[model samples]
Target: MKDILMEIIESKRITLREQKKAVPAQLLENGASEERKMFSMRRALANSSTGIIAEFKRKSPSKGWINRDASPEEVTAAYQANGASALSILTDTPYFGGDLKDLRIARPEVNIPILRKDFIIDEYQLYQAKIIGADAVLLIAAALEKDECLQLAEKAHELGLEVLLEIHSEKELEYVDSAIDMVGVNNRNLGTFVTDVENSFRLASMLPKDMLLVSESGISSPETVKNLRQAGFRGFLIGENFMKTSNPGEALGSFIKQLN
Candidate 1:
């Protein structure tokens, strides 16, 4: 049987195709060029004391409906006010209960970099991200071959957007390239949906020393962030812990205070 990750990617391809038909790539390019400006997630994380990339997500496939009615403006503004180094907004509507509109809504509310959290497979999506006002885009190594990953990363850079390459295992490290801005190790296994924080710890040493490292997914506590920082992780992508709460910004504020 096909795993959930594969299923989602397949479905995403169909969705992308349909979307491309509705809004041609040329149109996307024109709109992208008219965008205000792009922020650097890498620079923000490097300069921050906490290096927290607070995410805005409504739901996930594994847990289902984490915060169904969460507002982007409210939650993201809170994240910024609470010392978030950056912002990540999920734009996959089908599985993640998010839309591109979420990022658009949250963009004006925060000053830090915003990462467009999606399974980016096509170049069109990169243009869409630029047009939608995303600072960076996620490229999952598990979803694309090495060449495809490189092509996307290069294109993202060409469009003046940063690339956050996410890898779950050691083999995926080959996806790393010069065009990629940051390397993110996702603790959750996309195939099985099993989460293990140790994955980040285990893979930390294998990454390039010159590359900025980020630990993504399953990071909940300040203690875990401290440990990961000791293990050489410079950035942390946290979502569920704050998003599941009644006030994500206040929760993030409290979490940052604990970190300090």
Candidate 2:
């Protein structure tokens, strides 16, 4: 592999600089200070019968465009109506074919917790998430230094946004702590973009017992979800499976029916 994860991060740094200069942190801060509607993804997953965190993503680094013309608002509303516990909206444009506007567009359509899924390397993104109506943000352990991850999580908290720390292997388990709202096991390797759902099962017993656990990527079967639930996972972040279909919401509804 070509270390694609670092490639994305490097591109992200450039994009961040341009974004900060164009929008200014103060503007984002002021907008974020204004109270916005909020929902608790952690609570939603904990109380739900089917813990499906449906994602609104247009593309991926490995698979390229999944659903190029999907509308954020329409798909998200359908996910909620179908039985999604929460929503994960990709806000990174270069690799994910998504932008902050997706969250802004999807926010008013659903009431569930909206997690801004991206390669977060700065607090400025946290302010942007809040201002645009995100309830939570994903912090990939592979994408940050130990201290950098903790600092970003802390800043997310200060802005009243929950942090879902994503880890790929057991070493990243050390990233888990009191500040994290949820711990997610990403089945996909960021470096190679390969997926293995077993990663979640492999790490299930090691994750913090009290913390909510989420299984991200490579999950398409209801049986796998059932097995993961038994393994201690409460939230399932599934994107490509649903997004690849023409009727994503309907696909999600069918998946939930199978799950039950």
Give the top-scoring candidate (TM-score).
2
Of candidate 1, the 10-residue stretch with the lowest lDDT total is 29-38
Question: For every model shown, what is its TM-score relative to the native structure?
Answer: 0.98, 0.99
Q: Across residues 63-87, which tens digit of lDDT does each residue of candidate 1 receive?
A: 9999999999989999999889999
In lDDT terms, which candidate is top? 2
**Ten residues in sequence with the least summed lDDT for candidate 2:** 29-38
Model 2 gets an lDDT of 0.94
lDDT of 2 by residue, 1-260 (tens): 59999999999999999999999999988888888778999999999989999999999888899999999999999999999999999999989999999999999988899999999999999999999899999999999999999999999988899999999998998999898999999999999988999999999999879999999999999999999999999999999999999999999999999999
Clashing pairs in 1: none
